[model samples]
Target: MPSQKLSTLEKVGFGAGDMALNVVISSMMLLITFFYTDIYGLKTTDLALLFVLVKVVGAIADLVMGQLTDRYTSKGGRYRPYLLWLAVPYGISVFFVFTTPDWQYSAKLIWAYSTYILMTVMTAGVGIPYISLVSALTNDPKERLSANGYRLFFAKIGAFMVTIIVPILAQKWGDGNPAVGYQAAMAVMAAMGIGLFLFCNFTTTERVVHVVEKQSLLAQLKVLLRNDQWLILCGVCVTGTVGYVVRGSVAIYYAKYYLGGDTETVAAFLSTGVIAAILSMVASTWITKFYCKVKLFRYTQIAVAAISAVIYFTVKPGDMALAFILYFLLSFVVDLHAPVFWSAIAETIDYGQVKTGKRVSGFAFGGISVCQKAGMAVAGGLVGILLSYFNYQPNLEQTQFALTGIALMFSVIPGFFHLVMGMLMFKYRISDDYYTEVKVQMRDSGYIAG
Candidate 1:
């Protein structure tokens, strides 16, 4: 049997893949809606359509990539070769998504759809493989958890960089034209993504190779349908992601308008949340060693809902200091579930295999990705609709009503979704002890190498 342990270098290498992937992930979460409205010259109503349509394309692409990973193999292994082949394409896609061409409004809208859809496809091309790569890396649950800790930490670092550097770079380089500035800044970020993916490709190895039984698309869906734990996770993923994306999408606007922040303050505010998330990754990993991870996941989200309510009621307009402290607290508590949630995916797969007497690897991970996209779609649509409903105007002083709407989106609305997320987790029954029992059965049955 392959050793369950992973080297520190291997852990860092694995983490780099998420760092690279976050170039697009963080952008979509933090910058894309704002970019379309303020920089790229798209209407809020149109932005809703663009986000939903693009994610629909992304969902189809994820399913296709999942099937490809299951059927194709190379010397680099099933999942890693995509990192080598798709890195450049993915980086280029990121650049194009941020690029703003000088064109008529209608033509520019077409460009937005085309480029965003293309980026979504390219994102799935590598994203499904990178996420699925975790299953191939090691079978040890603890090792997977540790590696995910590293992965999420670095992922936040990527987000941290985006929040801090993109605004500053756009301001410095745009020469008063934000379109040109965003393009130039994201190009630098894109190049870094390519290099990081290459580093991840070179340093990581696939050690736990599961025998993926051939199944038709319909058959695999049936297998996943039977997985109750996975279904719960899919539900948690959607609700949790909706909350996350909503808050993230509104944060820039909240910082700039509601908090009355300048460019530096905006960057600082965004970075503070990411900084909290980075620390949450570390704290989660440490706390899981003593506390029950499932409990931690359940409670922290509930705590986030409470914090969100607090921030909404207490932090008034232009209350920068109070807003920052509460936002930091909210961000920190909200993300405590991340590492646990990611590691739980692999365990759910194992549980599925044991229950169904078959393994569905790539498609399972892809399904989770689909859930994430679905959440983004829902959140994105809500954001656009709510912004329009609230009469939000880009780069302008807003009405009292509009500012209140933005505040609700940032705190109360997303907080409600997170409360649902935490409540749903009450149904997830897989503890570490239960997963060990599942693994032992797999080994005795010869489903995996012993």
Candidate 2:
């Protein structure tokens, strides 16, 4: 068997990859909608089309990147090379997405579409390989879990930066022009993203290289479809992501309009949620040592749904203190499933191999990415439609209808999806004990090295 242990430095390095990734992800979830509407001057209908089209393209890019990863291996390893090669491009794409050109409305829309799509493609280039790198790091499930814990912890740090730093910096830098401020602030973030990706590339090593079979994409997909556990994870990904994206997208609106907060208050509100998520990463790591990870995943999400309902019913507009407290609790509980969910992807791959006798790696990782994109698409569409329905007007006092819709988006509407996500986890069976058996079987059968 390959070495099951990862050094602290190596774990930190792996974590850095996700941190870099979250610079984009956190922005997409938290700031993109607000940026488009309030700062960038996109109409709700245009924003809806932009989100849907970009995600559709992103899904396709994920599949293509997956196939590319499976077909190629080099001195840099199967996944790390992408980080090195795409880091600059990825950073540039991020900068461009936030850059607002002084052009006509149609021209600006085209630019938005072009830059967003490019960023998504670049994300796929790095993202698929980064995720699949987990399987390559080690076959030991416990090590995978620990590494993922670190990964998620750092990912939250990256998100925290986006929430706390971006708005503050943008306001300061732009002075009078919010657009200029956003561009400058994101430029700093983009540079950090590139550096972190390079650090990840240099510090991590891949030990468990699978002997992948040569199969058509269609054939590999067929195999994956048959793996019920993986399918369940995909469903969980889609539903959970929808909830996450919806809540994140509306948080700024909730703070600004619903809570009657200014820029600093909005920043503080978003930072509170992210800080709670950061703590949840550590808490999940500790809790899983004794409690069943699967149970933790299920119950915390269920708790999130209940907390969300409480926030929706109890916290009226301008109830800043209650809103912050409930939001913190909701954020903490909702993310308890994250490390478990990521680590479970590697386990489900192993389970799929043992049951079907075919090793499917890249496409499986890619499929999860696709499911996440699909969730974002659904969430984005909903946000766009709901904003229009609520008669939301940018940078103004919202009508009661608009404020209520924003509140619902932040709480109840997304909570329903988390509820379904928790319920779906009930069918997932790959506990640590079960995964240990799958490992033994794979090794004994020579599907993996003995």
Candidate 3:
């Protein structure tokens, strides 16, 4: 990819797509627990198990889609086809997942497996490839950062809005029936999902088209594993994701029980994170220009971990004001990593090609997606097991230990992952100079003008 800039129109569309993506994804993440237990009428343990299963299955689909994406090309190019193929179906499935009929737990689980699995396959297949397309879109390390950062900045805004809106919609709708609220919420979000995927597909075109190769399955896997930078960075991303999934998973609990609020209050707190994320990422554009990305990530991670630890100990049952304040600070630091890490992934595509003389951005990110799904899977199982062990009861008073346990999950788990991510990132070798060399050598568009 070269240093060419996306057009102003394309940029607007891309940013909108990013915003809608996060809005839907975060709304799901932020609300699914309550949805499962209350609206779907599934047991908490069953709900958690379902969450884990869907993520793991989706992770597997990500690998297949990634490989196919790298191997398959068309007039539309390597990745854009997925944006079209999966967009509508993905939205439909999301709606179904959110608003299944009230039935026996067994029947509900079956529907859960069916639509959730299908949705995961289509969405992950499309998403991993679509995200990887950024590598081929622009090779300017800075441009890549700006595009992804700008995208995330707006995405966080959408997430903030959805966080505020979804619960209210759920409440207003649930007054009639909780499932109906869930159904309405999903329908609205699905519309957004379908629209965004379509817009992103048409707005941006692919560059740096790879010569499609007929290679054995094993060969593709081998190529990806051989890329040293991808291996390390993907590993770090997985660990960080463990932290993220855990935090997101437990944040609901933290807000509701530890703070003694309802789900609506939890949504309000998450909205705070969403709001802070926008400002932080927008501010990061200046920081990215002056400061090294790895260094910024390191400082941010340490600060997040340290502050989280403090908040965990200091947050009292009544200190809602202080808790919100501390959480907002953590939110700012934590959101900073989204743009930095994703922008870094774009760089890894260049580094891998430079070192191996082969560009398999999809394959590289397939492995990347594995870490993400793995984190969710492990956290889901552990959370289920933890909830079961702690005697977590819905529609009743939660145990003190369970509340404390959930708080630790948010603070300690991500804290540890951040520590590991900080260490792994120190080894990332692609600097601005290295990226320039890679584009020049390949005759890619992002080669900075001399």
Cα RMSD, each candidate: 0.8, 0.8, 2.7
Q: Write the per-residue lDDT of candidate 2 for residues 288-317, one digit (tens) a residue.
A: 999999999999889989999999999999
1-450: candidate 3 lDDT, tens digit per residue: 325777766656666667656644675456666566656767767867787888888788888887788777789977877878888887887787786776777888898778778777767856786677776666567777887877787688778767777777877877867678768876887888788878888888776554444566677677777877778877777777777767776677777777887767877887887788788988788787887777787778777778878888888765689888988888888777677777777677656666666556666677787777787677666666666777777657777887777778768766877778777877777666776676677565432222
List TM-score per model, in order.
0.99, 0.99, 0.93
| Regions more than 4 Å wrong, model 2 | none
Instruction: Return the candidate ranking by lDDT, descending.
Output: 2, 1, 3
Among all windows of ten consecutive residues in candidate 1, which has the lowest summed lDDT? 441-450
Model 1 lDDT, residue 370, Cα: 97
In terms of lDDT, the poorest run of 10 residues in model 3 is 441-450
For residue 229, model 1's alpha carbon misses the true position, in angstroms, by: 0.2
Please give the lDDT score at residue 251 for candidate 1. Answer: 96
True lDDT of residue 269, candidate 1: 98
Candidate 1 residues lying further than 4 Å off, grouped into runs, are 1-3
